[model samples]
Target: METLLQWFDLIGIVVFAFTGVLAAGHKQMDLFGAVVLACVTATGGGTTRDMILNVPVFWLAESYYLWIAAATGVISFYLIRYLQVPMRLLMIADAAGLAVFVVIGTQKVLALGHTPAIAMVMGVMTGTFGGLIRDILCGDIPLLLRREIYATAALSGAATLVILNDLDVLPGEAVVAIAVLVTLGIRLAALRWNLSAPIARMRSH
Candidate 1:
């Protein structure tokens, strides 16, 4: 079970790294910048999780994480230009990565005997921080900072996982699946509706 979870994490890392590289390409950044964004997007959330939990960083424990990010970045650099529908591809991959990371983060915090509230926050942080970093590096507003439907979707999914676990209605694999589906569904709906943060009311001059 643990091994499967680790593989899921790796998959998420790769997907996010690919999107990061795509974002970098859109910005016309050099190869170095693309790879840097990829690394940040792949490892930033996991790094934050480790620091919060005081655990050894997952990438440091396993070199495969670094290798995967690097390889994905290089591949994306060559393939990004050929992608005619980059935004759609990026959105799908980003949603997949977000869902996977949320479950992984929630499970890790739960294993540490943390409260559900803390676990949910950690789950969101783990799911979104990488994209936050990638956006910052690309000179775009971080999705989390923009009040978009992004982090909200992750939190909703993570919260659901915790709730279902407490009720014993779901176990390991089922929990992850439900979390992923919920997150992905919310994300796609938000995109379809063009949902965004509510507009702030203007003050009278």
Candidate 2:
């Protein structure tokens, strides 16, 4: 189980790093800037979660995560130019990373003896914060601040996982897997359909 979780973490790191690289590419950043952004985006969320939980940050204990992010950054920097629409690639990678991180984050909080509510919050933060930081660094409006269904998807998935765990309806791994699928499905659907939350408009007196 630990090994499986570690693999998932690595996958999330790589995909988020790819998204970061795309963001930096969109800004026409140099190689060093791209690498820095990738590393930040890949680890930012989990780092925040760990700090909030008063635990040791995961990347500090595991150097391989940084290596994975760096490698992904270098690879994406070269490959991004070949794509006609790099932003589309960024969205896809972000969705995948978000899904994986949500599950991992919820499980980590639960393992730390936190309540389900706290777990869900951490899960949402884990899934969304990296992209938030990436966007801010790239000079784009953060997706979480937009009317899109980004963080909502993470919340829904995390809530589902918490509910399933409460009911003891499935194995731990199975529950996590289903939550990830739910997140990914919702995010992808939103992207395909241009779904978004209704915007609030202030009426002039």
Name the top TM-score candidate: 2
Clashes of 1: 0
- Lowest summed lDDT window (length 10), candidate 2: 80-89
Local accuracy of candidate 2 as per-residue lDDT tens digits, 108-159 = 8988999999999999999899999999988889988899899899998899
For residue 105, what is the lDDT in candidate 2?
Answer: 95
**Runs in model 1 with CA error above 4 Å?**
none
- lDDT per prediction? 0.87, 0.90
TM-score of 2: 0.96
Segments in model 2 whose C-alpha atoms lie over 4 Å from true places: 83-85
**Candidate 1 residue lDDT tens string, 22-92:** 88888999888999899889999989999988999989999789889989999988887686646677777
Candidate 2 whole-model C-alpha lDDT, 0 to 1: 0.90
Clashing pairs in 1: none
